[model samples]
Target: MKQIRLGLYQFGDRLIMRARHDWIVWTLVTAEGQARWREERRFPLTVTAAGIVRDLLAS
Candidate 1:
């Protein structure tokens, strides 16, 4: 189960956004920016190829 990050934006302190497949894993981290206490959301393989291309470009 491989998850890819599509996009992320900081809303003051917390990070949130969209992703897809394999699949996209959305993590809701502590507002203090700690990864220890976080929740994850799994999305199906529905994100567009362009999104992946954009991710690659950023990478």
Candidate 2:
């Protein structure tokens, strides 16, 4: 199994979660940013927004 890691940070009022495999990056933003990501990016559903990102990257 490959190890998956998540990087977290806070910018302004939003929490950003990044899932990276090698050089590819999938960004998941939460709070107000999540709302915008859902609207504009059509984010997938999961237990949480961050979970969705984690799962996507793991796959």
Candidate 3:
């Protein structure tokens, strides 16, 4: 199995996740931030980042 590592940080009021694969950095925002973003457009609230990585890996 290959090991994967992620770096997490907070910027202002947002949580950011960063992972490096090869020479590229992949960035993802916490679910709450995403929700707020959607809410700005009048979209319904949805899942957060709490279980996002697990859910994606399980799928």
Per-prediction backbone clash count: 2, 0, 0
Better of 2 and 3 by lDDT: 2
Which lDDT tens digits does candidate 1 get at residues 1-59? 42335343344445444454343444555567764323445543335565667777888
Q: How well is each residue in 1-59 modelled by candidate 2, as lDDT tens digits?
A: 22223344445434334433322233445556553231122233454556668889999
Displacement of residue 27 (Cα, Å) in model 1 is 0.5
lDDT of 3 by residue, 1-59 (tens): 22223333334434333333212223335545542221111211223443465568778
In model 2, pairs of residues that clash are: none
Better of 1 and 2 by lDDT: 1
Q: Per lDDT, what order, best first?
A: 1, 2, 3
Top-lDDT structure, candidate number: 1
| Stretches of candidate 2 exceeding 4 Å from the true structure | 1-46
- What value of lDDT does candidate 2 attain over all alpha carbons? 0.43
Q: Estimate the overall C-alpha local distance difference test score of candidate 3.
A: 0.35
Higher TM-score: candidate 1 or 2?
Answer: 1
